[model samples]
Target chain A: MIVYLLCLLLFCVGLYCILRKRNIIKIIVGVIIAEYAVNLLFILVAYRRGGRAPLHSPDAVIENMVDALPQALVLTSIVISLASTALLIAIAMRIYQKYRTFDITKIRELRG
Target chain B: MNYFAGMIPFFVVLALGGAFLVSLAGRRLKIFPDIAGLLTTFSLLLLSVLAVIAVSGGGLLVYSIGAWRPPVGINFVLDGLAAFMLVTVNLIAFLVSLYAVNYMERYTDKWKFYTLFLLMLGGMNGVIITGDMFNLFVYLEIASIASYALVAFGTEKHELEAAFKYAVMSTVGSLFILMGIVFLYSYTSTLNMAHMALVLAQRGTSNILLMVSILFIMGFGLKAALVPFHAWLPDAHPSAPAPISAMLSGVLIKSLGVYALCRVFYNVIGINPALSSVFLVLGTLSMLIGVFLAIGQWDLKRLLAYHSISQIGYVILGLGLGTPLGIVGGLFHLFNHSVFKSLLFLNSGSVEYATGTRDLNKMGGLIKKMPVTGRTNLVASMSIAGIPPFNGFWSKLIIIIAAVQAQEFFYAFWAVLASILTLASFMKVTKYCYFGRLKEKLKGVKEVPVCMKVSMSLLAIICILGGLLILPRGESLFLGKAGYSLLKGTSYGNEVFEEVNK
Candidate 1:
């Protein structure tokens, strides 16, 4: 329960970094943090106490095993996050090339 | 017919393969990207027609990814609603690809554009057809990520900024959806939508399902640009290239956002009174707020983007009402909105192509110079503004009548009032952009290219004929089946599972 609360706090912190940071790279890092937090939560959901590896052996009796699905899901989610981060980094590099600044406040060509 | 069912993977493979080849040889062969993009999208159009025909008989068809049965293996479920959505997505995709043939001539590395566009299309079709929650999320990300790149395709200052904002917000939304899926998976221990629905129904109203539903509402609502979550759209829609604008507003949000929202709420979760009320409030808010914000925009695509939000409000309102007529009206409006919204966006694209500016203030007397574009704009504007005899009027009228018949007098009143405001706004658009005196500075502008003109005219013709879907025979084939699926609610699970087991 405390661990879940800690995860929620970390999620909120990442969100705060995203919402409050003015640096483009910082915000990207914030997004990465939030994604990791969610991924961690997903993995944690599958954790079980005194769990053996989700493997079968005819000789041994197994009492508990971790949920394998969320781990598999997390791997996919991590790959997706990796792709988006790469794209975000590429876009950020281009933005720097265009504007010569890392501050999002300085990049104000589009407005309401 | 079974061979036709097996062709689903072919469409995905063709588009992705073409995208891959284009990206590889884009530099060496300039014309290759254009031909490949056009051919790929055209074949998708053909497959969409076949899917529609197969599903038009009001039965469900399931395509197993690897001959894996449902509740264990992944499957794509095609029904009336899915077919209708596919036709709308691929239809616009083909036209937009054709338009891109002419429009992207000024841009270098056109292959990248085609690749991202096809990837986006593949993602949308996957979303529309996939029967599992996690698969839907993966497809949604594929589409969303590709769209983020497409929105920033120009690599200009504003385009990059808009893309950054769009990418960040949309990625966050995807995380939320992923979180919701994790919760649902943890609770139900199944990812297949039909099996999950059965588990949920047997378990009955667990607190976890309610939580997942709220998370989904937020996630998908942000994607759909419902009033509260609509800030990203005005910037993102206008910042993209014109064809991208049409695809983004036309079907991306609907397929990714609205379609997913409805599928989860209506089919998987089973919409109860609580969810219905939430829909009602959100729909009404989006309807009222979107048009209000749109009335002041001078940027043509920006104005149209806001209207997309407002129009989507109508779809949600109809669906939320949960009556038979209301469902029919909502589904009809959904289809009609895709048709006319893309048409209007295409018109703006043409206007931008000829003038190189999207500001309405800079584009006057274009009608004198560009008759095809001007005339089509007139048709789309009239249709969207709910003028009598055009497609928008029929759907809006059906929704209003349905609202009244359901004895929701106040909603009906608001619907009529919103329609009038819509008319006023579109009138302002037509008068400012096409009619009145030709601007002295804009005298050099000519009509758009032939392909662009052809695409716009085809959609405009559809706009003129769109009201026929509500006629008796047309209703039975299209809107009726879609509405029946929604009205039947949780019974969708039974139908899908039954078809799969067969």
Candidate 2:
């Protein structure tokens, strides 16, 4: 239960950073943080009390192994997160080159 | 014999292959990307047609990966809903690819555009077809990330800013979805959607499911550009090039946002009283707020983007009514919106192509020089404004009728008022841009290229005849089946599993 609470706290922290931060790079970091928190939560969900890995063997019995699905899912999610992070950074770099600032308020050429 | 239904992966493989081949040859051989892109989309068009036929005749087709049967292995389920969505996704995809062929000449790396475009298509297809929860999340990310890159494809000042905002909001939304998936997997200990639906049914409605549903609403609602979470759309949709603008507004949001929401709410999680009320509120909110926001915009694409929010609200409102007639109306609106909205965006692209500007204030009397573009824009504008005999009017009429039939008269009134507002705004569009005196600076502008004209004409024809889709014969194969799938709701799970076991 504490772990779940911690996960929520971490998520809230990331949300704060994203919502409140004016710096583009900080927002990117916030996204990364939020992504990791969710990935952590995903892995945590698959955790079990002394559950063996989802593998079968005729001769040997395995006990107390971690749930492998979320681990596998997390790896894939991490790669996707990495792709987004890289793309975000690249776009930020371009924005900086054009606008000469990372402050989002200063980059307001587009409006309704 | 039914087990060989595992050919689902081939679509993704083909799209990925097209991406690779385009990137490899795009630098040295421009013709290669054109042929490859066109051929790829054409094949997808054919595949979507086959899928439609298969769904109309068969009940549901489940394709398990690696011959690993469901409840254990990953499965791709193609039912009427998936098939309907596939046709919409790929049909627009093929059109956008065709438009991009001529429109992308001004941009530098045509290959990168096609690559991201194909990737996004592949992601959407994966999302629509996958029958597992985690797989859906992964595919959603794939599509979302690719779209983020595509939005920034221009690398301009505004493009980067919009892409940055889009990436942050979308990633945040994805996190929420992932969190929901985590919670759902934890609660049910199953990834297969049918099996999860059975488990959820067995457990009945719980607080946890309600929480998951709220999380999903926030997540997919952000994608769908619902009223509260719609800050990124006006900026993001207008930032991309025109064909892309069309694709993003035309079908991407519908597929990723609205379609996913309906599937999860209706089929996987099973709709309930609280969730139904939630949809009602959100749908109404988006409808009222979106049109009001759009009424004041002068930027053509931005106005269209806001209208997208408003139109999506209509779709949601219709679906949330939860009657068979309402579901059919919503699905029909979905189809009509794709047709006219894409046509409108393509017309905007042609305007931009000719005038090098998207500001409505700068364009006037363009109908004289660009007759094809102007006439098509007129058709699209009329449809969007819900004029009689066009596609949009029938759908909006059906929705209003459905609301009234369901005794949601207040919603029906709002729908009527919003439709009037739409007509007023679009009237402003046509009067200022197409009918006024010819501008001094735009005297010699000619019609767009043959390719652009051809694509725009094709879409315009559809928009004009779109009312025919609701006719008895047309509805039977297309709209009827799609609506039936949604109306069936959780029974969809039984249908898919039964087909799988066959």
Candidate 3:
């Protein structure tokens, strides 16, 4: 329970940085933080008290293995976040090149 | 039956294959990307129509990967709903790609655009067809990332800024969805949506389920641009190239946001009174506020983007009623919105193509110089405004009637009020953009190319004929069948399992 609460706290920190920070790079870091927190939480949820490593071998007993599904899911989720992060960074670089600054408040060409 | 069963996975393969193939072949041949992209989307359109037929004949079809039975391996399940969404997505994709062939020449690399376009198409198709929750997330990210890149395709100041804002907000939304899925997986010990539905039904509702629902509402709502979560859309949609703007507004949000919401809530989470009221409130708020904000926009595409929010609210409102008529109306409205909205965006793209401006006040009497674009724009404007004989009217009327039948008088009244507001704003669009004497800056404009003209005309014809979908035969074949699947709700799990066993 405490660990889960910590995970939530980490996610909130990321959200706070994302909502409050004015730097584009900082917001990207915040996204990374929040994303890793979710990944950590997914891993945390699948941990078992007496779990053995989940590997399939001919002579090894496979009892009480921690749920391996979420581990695989988290790996895939990490890859996806990597792709998005790369794309985000690419866009941020272009934005910086165009605006010549990283402050988001200074970039206000698009507005209602 | 077996052949149709085999066609399910090909939707994903063909789209993804087309994406990579375009990238490879486009380097050698200048026109190869155009041909490959067109053939790919045209084939996709054909497959989705066949998919509808497949569903119409058989009840449900589940394609288990590697012959692994469901509940363990990834699965692609196609029913009336998936087929409906596929047809909607691919139909617009084909037309938009057709328009892009000519419109994209103004950009530097046409192949990159087509590659990302096909990748996005594949992602949307996968989202509609996949049965696993994690697979859905994967596909959702694929689509979202592609759209982010497409939004910044021009890489101009405004485009880059819009893309970054959209990417961050959408990534956060995707994380929320992922977090929800993780909790669900932990709770049920399964990732398959159908199996999870079974488990959820057995376990009944819990506080965790409530949390998941709220998370989803935020996640998908942001994707769908539901009012408060809608800050990214007006910037993102208008920033993309016109055909891309059309695609984003037309089908991406519907598949990623609306369809996912319906599938999860109605099927997996099992709809309840509290959830229903939540949908009603959110849907109503999005409808009124979106239109309210739209009227103030001078950017034509931005205004259409806001209308997307208003129109999607109608869809959610109808689906939330949880009645057969309401579901049908919502589903019908969804289909109609995709058609007319794509047309409106395409028309906007054509206008931009011709006059080199999206500002309504910058041009006038476009009806004389660019007759095709102006006329089609008028048709689309009427359709979106819910004028008689156009497709939007029938669906809006159905939703309004359904709302009254469900005795949600306030919502029904708002729906009507929004429709009227839609008319008033569109009239502003016509008066400023199409009607009156030609503006000084627009004197040299001409009609668009043949491909664009053909696609826009086809979409307008569909808009005018869209109401026919509500007829008995058409309804039973497509809209009614799709609505029926949603009406099945939690039985969706039982149906998938039954089909898999067979």
Candidate 4:
């Protein structure tokens, strides 16, 4: 129960960083943090108190195995996050080249 | 035609294969990308038409990946709604690719654009066809990420800024969606949507389901650019190249945001009075706020982008009423909006191509110079503003009538007000950009090339013929099937399961 709360806390921290940060790189990092927190929460959901490694052996009776699906899913989620982060970083680099600043406040060419 | 069932997976296969083959051979063979893109999207369009026929015959069509049965393996489900969206997505994709063939000449690295464009098409097809929750998320990311790159394709100052903001907000939305999926999986212990729906029906609802619903509303609403979460669209849509703006505005938001939201809430979770009310308020807010914000914009593309928001609100309003007529009106509007909106964006692209500017204030008497573009823009503008005999007028009328029928009088009034304001704003566009005195700077501008002309004319012709889609006979083949599926709601699970057994 406490572990789940901790994961929620971590997610909030990432959301705060994303919402409150003015630096472009910091916002990107905040997205990364939020992504990791969600991935972590997914892993925790699959965790069992005293489960085995979800491996099968003819010699041993299978019992109390942890859910393996979320683990596999987390790997895919991580790859997706990696791709988005790389793209965001590339965009940030180009924005810096154009506007010469990492502060999002300074990059205001588009508006209503 | 038993083999018709087998063609379901080919939508994704053809698109992904085409994307890969284009990127691989495009560098060496410059013309290959164009041919491949045209062929793949055109084939996908034909397949989607066949899908509509297949579904109209009755019963769901389920394709289990790796021959794995549902609740244990991922499957692809093609029903009325999926076929509807597939047709909409692929139709726009084919036309946009055709437009891009000529319009893209101004930009360097045309092969790269085709590669990303095809990939995004594949992603959207995947999202529409997939039967599992996690599968939807994966495809949604695939589509969203490709669009992010495409929006920044110019790699200029404003493009990068828009793409960055779009990427960040979209990623955050995806995370919220992922979180919602995680919650659903944890609650139901199943990933297949049909199976999950069955489980929820058997187990009954809890607070966890409510939380998941809230998360989805936030996530999908942001993707749809509904009132409160619509900050990125005006910037991103105008910043992307025109054909891309057409695709993004035309199909991406519908497939990723509205379609997903409807599928999850109505099909998986099952809509109730409370959920329906939430949709009502949100839809109404988006309708009024979006139009009010749009009327003052002078940038042509940006104005059109803001109107995209307002039009989407009509779709949501119709669907949220949760009546058969409402669903029919909403689905019909969805198709009509795609036609006219893409046409409008393509027209804007042609103007920019000729005059090298997108400001409506700077364009004048363009009809005297570029007659085809001007005439097509006039058709699209009339359609979007709900003028008689145009497709937009029919759909908006249906939505308002359905709203009044449902006794949602206030919403009906707002819909009418938005329609009037839409006309006023579009009239401003016509007066300033097409009918006024010829600008000195734009005097030497020429008509756009053949391919752009052909594409714009095709869409404009559709805009004119769009109202015919709602005729009694035409309704059964098109909007009726899509609306029926949404009206079926959670019974969709039973339909899929029954089809899987066959």
Candidate 5:
């Protein structure tokens, strides 16, 4: 229960960074943090007390095993976050080249 | 299995292969990208028509991946709703690609454009058909990433800025959706949507289900550009290249946002009165606020972008009513909006092509110089504004009537108010952009290329005739079945499982 609360804390921290930071790079990091928090929560949800790896072997008895599905899913989720981060960074780089600033306040060319 | 059933996975495969092949050979062959794009989209359109026919025969088609049965492995399910979305998506894709052949010449990397366009198409088709929750996320990410890159394709200051904002907001939305999926998986221990639905029905509602619903509403609401989460759309839609703008506004939002939301809420999680009321309030807010904001915009494409939000409000409002007539009106309006909105965007693209300006006040009397674009724009404006004899009118009327019948007279009044405001704003568009005396500097502007003219006219013709889709004969094949599927709600689980067992 405490660990779940801690995960929620981490997510809140990331959201705070995103909503409060003016630096584009900081916001990207915040996004990364939030994504990692969710991924961690997923992994934690799959964990079981006194569980071993989900594997099969001859002459070995399987008593308790952690869920393996979420481990696989988390791996895919990490890959997707990597792609999104890469694209976000690339766009940030171009934005820097054009606006010559890391501050989002300075990048206000598009508005109503 | 029917031969048509075998064609399900090909929608993704063909588009994915075409994207790769275009990227591979387009450098050497100048015309390869154009031909490959047109062919791939045309074929997908043909397959979607067949899908509609297959569904009209009154059975769901389930294709188990690797021959692994459901509740164990990933699968693709096709029903009335999927077929409806497929047809709408692929039709816009084909027409938009047709327009891109000419409009994209102004850009440097035409091959890259085709590659990303086809990739986005593949992702959307995957999202529409996939039956696994995680697979939907994968495909949704694919589509979102492609669109982010496409929005920044120009790499200009405003383009990069808009793309950056769009990317950040959309990525956050995806993470929310992923988190929701994780909660659901932990609850049901199954990823297959049909199986999950069955489990959820057995387990009944819980607090976690409530949490997941809120997460999904926030996530898909951002993607759909509901009023509260709509900051990214006005910037992102107009920043992309024109054909892309049309594609984004026309079909991308509907498929990824609206379609996914409906499938998950109505089918997997099941809707309650509370949820329906939430949808109703949100829809009403978006409808009024979106049109109010739109009437003040002077940028041609930006105005159209805001209208996308207002129009989507109508769709959500109809679906929120949760009645047969309401769903029918919503689905019909979804199709009609795709037609005319794409036409409007394409018409904007054509005007920009010849005049090199998207400012409504910068030029006037384009009807004399660019007759096709001018006339098509007029038709689109009328259709979106809900003038009589056009498709928008019939759908809006249905929604209003449905709202009244549902005894939600307040919502019905707001819908009518929005429709009148829409007409007023569009009249402002025509008065400022098309009807005044030809500006001296714009006198040299000529009609757009043949391909663009053809595509715009095609969409305009659809706009004029789109009302017929809700007529008795056409409704049974298209709109009626789609609405019936939604009306079935959580019984969607029973239907899919039955089809799978067969």
Candidate 6:
């Protein structure tokens, strides 16, 4: 229960960073943080107390092993995050080039 | 045919393959990207039509990846709803590709454009067809990422800013969605949608379930641009290239946002009265607020983008009513919106391609110079405004009738009110952009190329003929089946399991 709340708190922190921060790179960091928090929650949901990796050996019992499926899923999610983060950085670099600043308020060319 | 059912996976393979194929071969041949894009999207459209035929009798076609059965492996589903969505998506995709053949010539790297376009198309098809929760997230990201890149394809200042804002907001939405999926998985102990639906049914509702539902609504609502969550759409939709604008406003939001939202809430989450009412309020808000904001915009594409939000509100309102007629109306409007919206965007693209301006004040009496684009715009504008004998009118009529029957008289009044406002705004568009007087500087404008004219005319004719789908005979083959499956509700679990057992 405590772990879940902590995970959610971290997620909210990331959300705050995204929403309240003015720097483009800081917002990117915020997105990464929130994403990692969610990924951590996925792992926590599938975790087992005192569990080891779910490796197989002959005549070994399967007890005390964490669920492996979410780990695999986390791998995929991480790769997706990597792609998005890279794209965000590339866009940020280009934004900096065009606007000459990392502040989002200045990047206000396209508005209602 | 069973063969067509097997062709489900082929849609994704062909699109993804064609994207890379174009990228590799387009380095040498300038025209190769156009040919590849047309061929690939045409085949995808053909497959989607065949898909509709395959599921005509109202059945589920399950394609398990690597021959693994459901509840264990990810599967691609071709049900009545999926089939209906496929035809809508791929049809617009093919037309947009055809339109892009001419419109995209203005850009420097045409091949990269085709590659991203097909990539996004493949992602949409995957989103529609996938039966696993996590796979849906993956595909949604793929489509969203490709779209972000496409929005910034020009790499200009406004384009880059719009792309950044869109990417950040959408990625956050994806995170919310992922969090929802994690909660569902933890509660149900399964990732397969059918199996999870069964688990949710057995377990009944809880605080955890309620939390997940909120997560999903926020996540998918943001994607669909539901009023409060709609900051990114106006900027992003108009910033992309024209054909891309057509694709974005046409089918992207429906397939990625609305389609997924309906699938999750109605089918997997087991929607009840509370959820239905939430959809109602949100739908109504989006309808009124979207058009109200749109009425004041001077940019042509920006107005169309906001109208996309308003039009989607009607679809959501219809679906939220949850009656069979309402469902049918909603689904039918979904199809009609795709057709006419794509045509409208393409018409805007044609105007831009010729005149190099999307400002409504600058264009006038273009009908005299560009007869095809002007006439097509008139058709699309009428359809969107819900004028008679066109496609939008029939669906709007059904939704209004459904609202009255459901005793939602207030919403019905709002619907009609929104419709009139829609007509007024579109009349403004027609008066300003195409009518009035031929401008002094615009006298040199000409009709678009053969491919673009052909595609726009095709969509316009469909706009005229689309009303015929509501005829008693044709509804069963298309809209009825799609709506019936949704009306089935949680029996959806039994339906999928029953199909897999066979």
* Candidate 2 per-residue C-alpha lDDT over B345-460 given as tens digits, one digit per residue, 9 for 90 to 100: 88888888899988889989999999998999999999988999999999999999999999999899999999999898999888878889999999979889888888898888
lDDT of 3 at B323: 89
RMSD (Cα, Å) of model 2: 1.4
Error of 3 at A45 (Å): 0.8
Could you give candidate 4's per-residue lDDT for residues B66-100 as a string of tens digits?
Answer: 98889799999998889999999999999999999
lDDT of 5 by residue, B1-502 (tens): 6567678999899999999999999988999999999999999999999999998986789988898999898999999999999999999999999999999999998999999999999999999999999999999999999999999999999899999999999998998899899999999999999999999999999999999999999999988998899999999999999999999999999999999999999989998999999889998998999999999999999999999999999999999999899989998899999999999999888989999999988978988888899899999999999999999999999999999999999999999999999999999888888889999899789899999999999999999999998889999999998998888888888888888787
Grade the docking of candidate 4.
high
| Alpha-carbon shift of residue B384 in model 5 (angstroms) | 0.6
**Native-vs-model 5 lDDT?**
0.93
Cα miss at A39, model 6 (Å)? Answer: 0.6
User: Candidate 3 or 4, higher DockQ?
Assistant: 3
lDDT against the true structure, each candidate: 0.87, 0.88, 0.93, 0.93, 0.93, 0.93
lDDT of 3 by residue, B1-502 (tens): 3568888999999999999999988977999999999999999999999999888963989899998888989999999999999999999999999999899999998999999999999999999999999999999999999999999999999999999999999999999999999889889999998999999999998889989999999999989988889999999999999999999999999999999999999888888999899889889999999999999999999999999999999999999998899999999999989999999999888898888888987978989898998899899999989998999999999999999999999999999999999999999999888899898878888899999999999999999888999899999999988998888889999989988886
TM-scores of all candidate predictions against the true structure = 0.97, 0.98, 0.99, 0.99, 0.99, 0.99
Query: Pairing residues by index, what is the TM-score of model 2?
Result: 0.98
Off by over 4 Å in 4: none
Q: Total backbone clashes of model 6?
A: 0
Grade the docking of candidate 3: high
Of candidate 3 chain B, the 10-residue stretch with the lowest lDDT total is: B1-10
Candidate 4, position B224, lDDT: 95
RMSD of 5: 0.8
Interface RMSD of each: 0.8, 0.9, 0.5, 0.5, 0.6, 0.5
Query: When superposed on Cα atoms, how far off is each prediction in RMSD?
Result: 1.4, 1.4, 1.1, 0.9, 0.8, 1.0
